[model samples]
Structure formats: structure tokens, C-alpha cells
Target: MLTPREFYVVIERDEDGYYVGEVPQLKGCYSQGDTIDELLTNIKEVIELCLEEQEESNKNLSEFVGIQKVSI
Candidate 1:
């Protein structure tokens, strides 16, 4: 059995009111849906697809450090 890997996802609501989600670990891995539940489901599918594509290309996933907010 393959060990499950954890990934951090960033979600935000766009101007059109669609919930957009992206996995930072995987480049160009993103998805959108109307609701949070749907967004999560969509993002999961996107992640799976990205993983498969990455495997085909033998791409390496970048390490996620953290996010920060700065006031200027």
C-alpha cells in the first residue's frame, strides 16, 4: 500500500463568488467550485490529476514552507 501524503491547499473566493483552490506543493494545480464542499471535491480531483501528470514527467514537488502576511 502506498503511504498517504499530505498537501496544503489555499482557498479563496474570487470576485465572481466562485471558491478557488490551489495546491502550492504542486505547480499549476488548481480548481474552482460554487461552494466549499464542491471546491474541496474539485480540488481533490485536480490534485490527483496533477499527481498523475507529475509521475509521468518525473517532476519533483516543491517543499511548502509557510505563508505570511505583512503590513506595509
Candidate 2:
């Protein structure tokens, strides 16, 4: 068994002032929006879609197998 991968994500404003989001841990996972709320919603949907795709394909979500972080 393995623990779920969780990492930080930050949304930034692009040249056209559009909200662009990226998941730091999941390479190439990104989304764009016209507003902050939309950006968050879009990113959530994107994450879900990515996870679902991995599940359907029977792929391990994370490429790493070692413990990333652990609580004391």
C-alpha cells in the first residue's frame, strides 16, 4: 500500500490577467480561468480528471514509492 500524494499549488496571473493554476507535484497538471473561484474549480476538476484517468488505466498516480512526508 501507498499513501496519497499531496503537495502545494499556487495560481498566478497571466499576461491577459487570466488565472492560471498548476499542481506542483503532478507534472503538467494545469488549468486556466477568468477568476479566482473559477481557477480553483477548474483545478479541482482537473485533478479529479487526472486521478480518474490514472485509475482507469490502472496506473500508479505517483512515480515515487518512498515516503514523501510523515507525521511525528
Candidate 3:
């Protein structure tokens, strides 16, 4: 059976003034653009790749319990 997975993204502006988007779940899945629209488009691909990676990784990790703690 197929399972669902989730991932996180972290976007920021760099010192050089470019918008940087990163997929934390998938290492090296990142992109930068001069504008928000471009960044979003680029990041969409980045996110998809991240999701694919998460699915691959889940093959080994899915058996373990998943938990998260956050403070807001």
C-alpha cells in the first residue's frame, strides 16, 4: 500500500539579495531566483523532488514512529 509523507521547506533572502528556497527533507534540493514568482516556481520543483526523496527514505524509516515538537 502507498503511504503519505510530509516535508518542510525553509526560504530566505541571501546576503547577495537573491531569494533562496530550500527543502530541509531532501538535501541539496534548493533554488534561487530574482523574484518571488520565479522563486516559487523553482521551489515547486524543489519541493516535488523533496517529496520523492522522502518517499524513498520512508522505505527504511517508515517503520519507526514519527514525532515532532514545536513551540510557537
- What are the candidates' C-alpha RMSDs? 0.7, 7.9, 6.0
Per-residue lDDT of candidate 3, residues 1-72 (tens digit): 868555545668999999997665465678999987898799888767766776777732223234467999
Comparing 1 with 3 on lDDT, the higher-scoring candidate is: 1
Candidate lDDT scores, in order, read 0.95, 0.76, 0.70
lDDT of 1 at 15: 100
TM-scores for every candidate against the unseen true structure? 0.95, 0.64, 0.54
Order of models, best TM-score first? 1, 2, 3
1 or 2: which has the higher lDDT? 1
Report the error of model 2 at residue 38, Å. Answer: 0.7
- Best by the TM-score measure: 1
Q: lDDT tens digits, residues 3-69, model 1?
A: 9989998999999999999999999999999999999999999999999999999999999999999
* Model 1 bad stretches (over 4 Å): none
Cα lDDT tens digits for candidate 2, 1-72: 978756455778999999998876565679999999999889988887877776787766444344355789
Task: Give the per-residue Cα lDDT of candidate 3 at 35.
Answer: 82
